[model samples]
Target: MLGIAAAVLFFIAFLINAADIATNDTFTSTNVMLIGLTVLALHVSGVGTGWGSRGRRR
Candidate 1:
């Protein structure tokens, strides 16, 4: 529940920033892709560590 709430808040904040940048013509596809890649990398790293720890515990 907390994770979902945080994700919702994050998405809302992202939308607000996106709207502001879009209005100013400052939002580029490259920037969006880079941000997406960064988030993906962080998620993968976190999940990998979590799974690895679980395997080691067995």
Candidate 2:
């Protein structure tokens, strides 16, 4: 559940950034690349890779 929440937050951040880019039309390539990388990293590390072990008892 924590991972899911983190993933959702990450996605919301990405959406906001995308909206900013769409409205301003002045966002740089570096900014876009960085945001993409951040989203990918968060998805893979926060949700995709760590999904299965999140709710188990030790």
Candidate 3:
């Protein structure tokens, strides 16, 4: 529940940042992609994001 909400929030913010960057012609950065990749990494690793942890004894 909490991880999904955090992911959703990150996604929404990423979209807004992308849109904001699209409106500007002088933009020369990969901030949006970095944000997206960060999200992906978090989702994949499931490390401390409320997602399932690997190698747990429980």
Candidate 4:
């Protein structure tokens, strides 16, 4: 679930950057990249979650 959220945010950021490139002469993508990268870091580090439910074992 966390991974899915991160992926969605990243995709949105990517689209924003892409649109900027397609419609303008000035290139600006740093803020979106930073937001996406921060989420990536959290997802990779397992800060809040990454482990499945702890109540069940199979």
Candidate 5:
């Protein structure tokens, strides 16, 4: 899920940069890209993955 969200953010950032869309300081392409990177990092680190749900069997 987070990976998908990051991909969307990256796509939005690319569109904003490619189209030269005017945005507020808070909504800049660089900022959005950074946010996407953070989400990607979290996804890679298994933050939102449900791996912890499985119990270990002896």
Candidate 6:
């Protein structure tokens, strides 16, 4: 799920940067790319993979 989210963010960043779209300071392409990287890192680190709950006994 998160991987998909990251992919979408990357795509959006690419479009923004490649198309030369004008954006506000907060939503710049660089910022979107950075946020995507952060999300990817979190996904790689198992932050939201649901592994922890699966091991719990009912």
Candidates' TM-scores?
A: 0.38, 0.36, 0.36, 0.51, 0.89, 0.87
How much does candidate 4 score in TM-score? 0.51
Kindly list the per-residue Cα lDDT of model 5 for residues 1-58, writing each as its tens digit.
9999999999999999999999999999999999999999999999998778679879
TM-score of 3: 0.36
Among all candidates shown, the one with the greatest TM-score:
5
Position 51, candidate 3: lDDT: 38
What is each predicted model's overall lDDT from 0 to 1? Answer: 0.52, 0.57, 0.56, 0.66, 0.97, 0.92
Q: Decide which is better by lDDT, 3 or 5.
A: 5
Off by over 4 Å in 1: 1-25, 47-58
Clashing pairs in 5: none
lDDT comparison, 4 vs 5, better candidate: 5
- Could you tell me which residue pairs clash in candidate 4? none
Query: Could you tell me the TM-score of candidate 2?
Result: 0.36
lDDT, residue 6, model 5: 100
Q: Is candidate 3 or candidate 6 better by lDDT?
A: 6
Q: Candidate 5: where is the Cα deviation over 4 Å?
A: 53-58
Q: lDDT per residue, candidate 2, 1-58, as tens digits?
A: 4445555555655775666644344445445455656666666666556457558779
Q: What RMSD does model 4 have?
A: 5.1
- Residue pairs of candidate 2 with colliding backbone atoms: none
Alpha-carbon shift of residue 45 in model 5 (angstroms): 0.4
Q: Which lDDT tens digits does candidate 1 get at residues 1-58?
A: 3334445546655775667655333445445445555555666557433455445455
lDDT of 3 by residue, 1-58 (tens): 4356456656766676766645343332354445555766766666556535456678
Error of 4 at 27 (Å): 13
Best-to-worst order by lDDT is 5, 6, 4, 2, 3, 1
Which candidate ranks first by lDDT, i.e. highest?
A: 5
